[model samples]
Target: MSQNRRDPEQVVAAARKGAAEAQRQQIEIIKQFAAIDCGTGDEEGNARVVEIIDRQLKLIKGIEITHHYAEGYGIHIVARLKPEKPEGKILLSAHTDTVFHRGDTAAYPYHEDGDTAYGLGIVDCKGGILVAIHAVRIMQEADMLPNKEIVFIFNCDEETGTPNGHAVFDTEIPGAEMAFVFEPSRDEDGVLTARKGACSITVEVFGKKAHSGVNYLDGRSATVELGHMLVRLYENNDNVRGIQFNPAALYGGDYGTGIVSDHATAKVGVRVACQADIDKVKEIIARVEKETYIEGTKTEIRIDRISVPMERNEKNVQLYETVHKAGLLLGKDLPEQASGGSGDASYFSYRGVPAVDALGPYMYKIHSTDESMRLSSFEEKTALFAVVLGIL
Candidate 1:
């Protein structure tokens, strides 16, 4: 990498000094986002988050704002800061929603104790949004805004990968050269280099219904067929290839006991390491679909959603090196790792854009009640991210 105009250490020191004054405001903003109670379906909470961020984005002069909606979700907030004489373009992304329900914040209200912030969405994304926004805002205060047009995207449905996450490629990535994503870090402050691809599948089975003890022979139990299909799915799961087929939910039958049900449904979550393996997993499901575990049972299948794999491509390797160099300048040795889970980074890389994932705060046990943001690590991320912006 060629030497950038700015010195990383001096730029970071100035940012840290500026951050020291506004650390309290950052905490307050995080609390505001966490207390909103935005889960997958809570439109009220989702809209509230947009409102809060909209107000913040408006403070930056010459910023253009717009919105994009995810399928069944509320919105994806987009903001751009274009200089009159700009160098190029950079895209920064983070999600606005969390995995907890609307009332989750009441049980786990936003509270901080010394080096940590505790709340429902504190680590998974609220904290990330805070870091990403403030990383630029603080740099701007130090007159250190990146020498590129910056686009900030806060999508609503990353926890449950939705239309907004993938929809961004068309609406948000135009003319942008690089994308930086802010999901939480993992395994002692590591950066994500690669991630698995996923496809959501649904299987439904139909059977004849009849009375239990009276006409048991006439009844072809859909429940029984589902049991056999579930086993076949399990058997087809390939461990060596890191392919997982999990039957997450099952629905069928009726409230009354003895009556055989005619309809049955199952939702399966599939994760694969490569995009090509999606077909392999599908063939496994197809093979099971053809099997007739029950004489009168019929089945239907649908692939609900799919995102191409975030394999470690050439762009990804180069981006990791850039982040690694930025970390070294800030006195942080950021390790790199591959994840089985999916993130917004996958979509960007699939579009042939070099993207970096997991640039948010450091925390453990995300998507759980125990989620907490380490204040110390949060400060480190703020500093390193500011330097990364300078170099990139």
Candidate 2:
């Protein structure tokens, strides 16, 4: 009874019935949101988003709403859309924070031309939120909404790897059968099947400082040792192993010239494709700390913020079938592919939920002033999403 192998023509056609006009009207949602500056940790900008979401959700009927917040992070809004008594739970994961700084919106206002809308976070997520909002509204009007506990989890600080939002997910992400994340499609028509996980590894070296001209032989240069250690860390970046290590920041020596450095620190970004690779990378980090290039230097390694890899698995393949069938109904190719970027959705994948991402729009330039997204995919992707409720 699955449409996984069904012909494209056999797909249903519901959203396209009037998808264009509906999207044209609702497109304003993204524009209005894009104009507001909601950078990571921007209180005023995030507050503006809270106001907008609060106003819009108020228009919908019969939905349970809850607010979760982090002390310094923004807010996480969860809304359950269904009858008081629902059939099942399907979680929709998304975020409201953008990488745009304050006043960036003022310089680059939301602009649209020839089916493309350019603005900060437009393709990254504001457009994604718009599609979901319109999908719910249109489905409500057509009386096609199924009796399912469709929970919409929108959190702040996703731009910063959901640091504070983890509290929000711990409270809500459980019990969901699956999670569909809207992170912008891999391409014009590609949905994500897998994504790399990331972590930060910080290594510090402590060395004895001595006069460069007089007691140089007794002194050990931590900076020189760090340089050798960097080579070892970067050697772990093996394409075959699906792991990448990049030295992001390096600080060595303190103050002026003619002095042996006492301290050196190297901050590296580690990305892994799977848990095996994650372990391998961790081992590599440990190995580097044990071997010191400088004789007198002591090395310390600290690895933090390990994210879950959304690896392509059998469960995700089945998930792709369901979403592909929904896409078929919309008469579009819904192919699945791997992505290199990590996101908050990693948590759900980490928590044992079959999750897929890149469900937003078709756009490339993200986190920059030239950011833009295809308008047509908004209608197309939303159309497919509108049908997912019935199928799930």
Candidate 3:
């Protein structure tokens, strides 16, 4: 039997209503959160929001939000939507924390300009969080929620590479069968099916500190040693093969004081398309760790595997199929895309659960001071989300 085609007029109307409701609901939540500055290690900020959401959850049936704390600066919020009867589980993941320093949002809150909103974390992820909430609300109103269980994960720390967040998730929801990450989509009409593996690493060099003029020969410069390692790391960059290693932050001695540096630090961000390539590059990092530039200076390496690549698979094909059919019913088409940026979808897909990211609306200038999500894409994405849930 052919699925009944949905009228674009009616669908758009429903989407418009849904979007308006969502925006209103979202704005309220944002205002509440914006009142409190939710930076990493801000327990009070996280607790305030979690407590509010929990109280609201008590009134809603089959929905529960749990809070878990990871080691320093790590928190995970798991929102579970379970139907009366059991079905497959679907995970919708988004991070709540922003890259901005503490009190940034409090100082510069959300502001609107025609159709766009600008704020510290507005586009990077808070918009995605609001989208998930509104989508779920629509699902409840339509009474079309599937027998399948839906879980919305609001990770506390994603901008910091989810060191503790990933561990908490792996321990909590090991049974999830599928996941959709509400990360900011790329440009317009962008959807993500694949992402590169990511790593967070710190390079520290130690050297003797001495006065520049009196004991210049007595001190080895750690900053110079760090530069050598950085130069070597850059030589292997290959844009064609999707391999890029960048030095995100570097700190060294005080230059104006004329003191030879005794310590230096550098943080590196590595992205790789394939697991084999990621493993291959570790040799280069290891080589740098072993070699020393300055005499009597030593270097220490702290390499961490934050998240792995989500390779394309058959399960992803099935998900795209369902999403595509739902789009057709609504007279829209959402193309499958492979993304290079890393997201929580990488965590689920790497663990064998098929996942798709960039499921939210089109967002621009993410992680910037002028970030914004398109006004139209909000309704479009929510409608698509509701339709997909009903179909499943």
- For all predicted structures, in order, the TM-scores are 0.94, 0.93, 0.86
lDDT of residue 355 for candidate 2: 82
* The candidate that achieves the highest lDDT relative to the unseen native structure: 1
At residue 278, candidate 1 shows an lDDT of 85
For candidate 2, write residues 1-392 as lDDT tens digits.
Answer: 22344333322344555455567755777788888988889877887887787666655577677888666766788887867676666778788999988899999998989888888887788777766766776666655666667788888888878888877777766667788888887565777868888888888888888899999889988888888888888776787776878888889877556888989998888787889888888788888889878788999888877877788887777887888878766666688888788887677877878888878888868888999888888888777777775455
The worst-scoring run of ten residues by lDDT in candidate 3 lies at: 1-10
What C-alpha lDDT values do all the predictions have? 0.80, 0.77, 0.73
Candidate 3, superposed: residue stretches over 4 Å from native: 1-21, 55-60, 208-215, 254-262, 291-296
How far in Å is the alpha carbon of 10 misplaced in model 3? 9.5
Candidate 2, residue 370: Cα displacement in angstroms equals 1.6
Taking the tens digit of each residue's C-alpha lDDT, what string does model 3 give over 1-392?
01244444454456556766666656556556555566666666666756655554444466887778765664578878887665678888888776666667767777768767666665567667767767777767655566777887888878766777877678646777788788876654656778887877798998989899998889889988999878877887777787777998999996645988989999998887767777766877888788777778999877766568878788876777777776776787778888777777877887888787887757778776566666666767777777776666
Task: Please report how far candidate 3 places residue 238 from its true position, in Å.
Answer: 2.3
Q: What TM-score quantifies how close candidate 1 is to the native fold? A: 0.94
* C-alpha RMSD of each candidate structure in angstroms: 2.1, 2.9, 3.4
Model 2, residue 112: C-alpha shift (Å): 2.7
lDDT of 3 at 79: 77
Q: For residue 352, what is the lDDT in candidate 2?
A: 78
lDDT of model 3 at residue 67? 77
Candidate number with greatest TM-score: 1
